[model samples]
Target: MKYLGIILSAIGLMIIINSCSKSWTDYSALQVQNLNQDSNTALNNKTYQTYLANLRSYKSSKHSIVMGWIEWGDKTSTANSTLNDLPDSLDFISILNPSNTLSDEKKQDLSSVQKNKGTKVLYNLNLQNWDDSLYSTFNKIGYLLNVDSAFQSQLDSVILAINSLGYDGVDVNVEGMNCSSCGSFFYTYQTGYYNRILDTLGKLYGPHSNTEKFLLVEGATTASLLSGTESYFNYYIANTNDYSWYYQVDNAYATIAQIPGFTNDKLIITTDFNDKSVSADISDKLWQYGGIPFYTNGSGTPIPSSTALLNWNPTSGLKGGMGIFYINYDYFNNDFTITKNIIKTLNPSGE
Candidate 1:
């Protein structure tokens, strides 16, 4: 009887161990399945907006949209290049300052521009560096990704400022997204943060306005980092150089095209007009890429436009119209002579 009792206890212990093992196996399999399902889901579920598409006829104004950067931080005063100085041909200008904290003079310039010019003033926020004291949201991206709600409304204040200023919308330019020190997990979490803010801005803009320019990544441009993120933005202002503008623009667009959701037409090449090499035939080159070429003044004399460019419409070419930067730069001057010449070439009737 003692041996039988001992055997019964042993059997009961074995059965209990087997039951627990089975439960664990089932739970692990369930977790793996859920992970696989979530992996296939797109980061952005909302469809890309197409209301103000066709960079060829941007803003329904028939002329290609010109984008200029009124960059702050430079000690130079933009007091001369106020909205009044911007021509009727200008489409969009981004306030590429670091923070909303503007000087009194800047505030007056912006307020006047928005109230009078009717030019779409986009708020350009730079979330590039991870300063310990500033932009705490960027400090611990891994933590923030999980609890994104904490500062999700933080961007709202900038938007509200835009509204109060009567500006068109906001343009976000994020850098340092690929932090080598933090590793791939940083990319993952930062990507998550971008996805979250994009969703938020999409809701803010609803169906009408261009919600955000958040995908312009300075750190990483890999398929892993950039692919689906393009769907979140409608317009992107790409920067290229004078010497290699053609191939540079081509490569940039190719990367953007890899996003599956982005087409060739979604990109606008905002080149530095400081290039003297900008011949009359440059438009033909931009058209070939199915993009609009916007030349913002930087330095040097931009190649003057001829009547040939005004009339030469190509059937084989894709025509994404073109424009220039704001009215001033030390080298280019506030008068924007080169930009005006290009605009005159595009819209000869206005001349």
Candidate 2:
């Protein structure tokens, strides 16, 4: 009986040992799985970092640049309304209606794109926003220089606002410069005053400036108006929404290119997405001039005057770049379909 009892005790000890051994084996397998997962995560992070670096290098290169004018909707609840949702490949984005009162979430979205995507954020400085009634006369941006009691107080406020808000630069709307009733004398005077304001902004944000920021001008009736101040701007975005023919676009580009400091590299030809009927054939023409083409169509299929802009490019050398106005609108359809197509067309992933 004592020998049998000892045998039972030995069997119980063996069972306990085997159970512990199984548990340890299971734990070891779990540890191996965790290690594999960690390794995969590390590798993925490295690949993404490399991709970001490559994208930044591409932006800094001499390739054509893609720019857009996006509405600043503080809420990210919508699909493509927020800055965070924009394509990572965009080189520059002009924030429409950017105010000092941006939410923390909005500010974070802006900073994230700038730091991670190497996209430069610019605030729109539409002179009409100051006072729409003054748009017809020299009392618009010119008001900032000549008429206002506080000399350049308005311009100073804008400079201060952009700096404090962490914007990369400004897109000055140079529309309303032409005044038929004001006569050529006042017009010339207003032009000088306008150029003065531009010079002020340029010293800090222009191409030759010490900082990396950009100063851009859009909405000029004639590129000739920009003659003396051409050097102050990084690019002259020819707002050609009113133009129906390719010749008009050509004329605009030719005029801007004629400016002393302006070159094909500094010109961006734009088409309004709001006008779906507008033909984008000018994109092909822009390629001939080495100018970047900006179109707003995203229908995916290439109709005669449609998003066909994405299907073609200069065969020999790289054309400047492309852009889209109201880029957020394209997001509503298929998540920036036209913008993505153009970017991929210009800078293919294979290259």
Candidate 3:
């Protein structure tokens, strides 16, 4: 009877051990699987961090940069309408109507792109023919700068807004400066005020400044207007209306290069994407001038022009870069085909 009870107890113990062994094996396998998943996650995260660092380093390098002007809109409105949908390799972007009125979703999208991609976001301060609803603050600043003696306050406000809103830089577009009715005194004063504003901005955000921000200017091409203040601007986006021929672009390049403080690398030649009548060849020649070919109009020949601009590079060296005015319009068939091509052409290595 004692041997029988001992045998039964041993059998029970074996059964319990077998069940515990099976459970332990299962648990061990699960732990190994979880560990593998964790390791993969860490590897992926490290790879992405390396990628971002490489991107930022490239931007800081002497290579040319791709710039675009995008009209801000809600991300949910349509495909490719938001900042997040822009090409990841784009170097810089100017928001056409960036203001305090931006929606939370739009702000978040802007922040995400700047953080994930090394794209610099610039605030567009258009001084001529801008919609009041979109650029009321800038328009007011422009008006005050032209007429008000206390325009320094408005200028301060602009800087404050740029800092508080977390913009990478500012794009100042001043057009219609050739006022036929205004006297020489008015013109001189206005020019001085503009230079003052640019000088102030340059101290803080110019290319040579300690800040990483950029200061860009357009339509201030006169010798008097740009002479002393030229150094304050990172790039002088040349007026593209007269660039219908290679010589025209060359002439404009020569003229701007003559400026005391301006350099060939600081010039940007713009074409009109809306003007289809412009030849793509003109866009291609922009590379020869050591500046980026920019799209400005929309009459007809956008694709060919864009193709020529992106594919062509000067043998002398890499051109400054290229830009598109209405960049969002290039988002067709649910893809940023032209923009992507431009980025790839400028930087052959994929970002």
- TM-scores across all candidates? 0.56, 0.70, 0.68
Across residues 1-351, which tens digit of lDDT does each residue of candidate 2 receive?
Answer: 111011111221222223211211111111221222254542245434454565566677666677888777755456566765667667889987778667776777777668756789998987645532333434555654454433266678888988988899999887754443455544545556677777788888978678988888886445555647777888877775444444565566666666775556666655445424333554343222222333334424223222333333333333355566777666654555566656655554312
C-alpha positional error of residue 44 in candidate 1 after TM-score superposition, expressed in Å: 49
Q: Candidates 2 and 3: which is better by lDDT?
A: 2
Pairs with backbone N, CA or C atoms under 3 Å apart (clashes), candidate 1: none
Clashing pairs in 2: 64-320
Candidate 2 deviant stretches above 4 angstroms:
1-44, 131-146, 178-188, 275-319, 349-351
Candidate 3, superposed: residue stretches over 4 Å from native:
1-50, 129-146, 176-185, 274-303, 308-318, 349-351
Q: After aligning candidate 3 to the native by TM-score, how far in Å is the CA of 294 from where it should be? A: 13
Q: How many residue pairs clash in each candidate?
A: 0, 1, 17
lDDT tens string, model 1, 90-165? 5567665536566665565555434333356677655443322223444563556533544455566766776665
The RMSD (Cα, Å) of candidate 1 is 27.0
CA lDDT, every prediction? 0.42, 0.58, 0.57
Worst 10 residues of 1 by lDDT: 1-10
**RMSD per prediction, one decimal?**
27.0, 16.4, 16.7
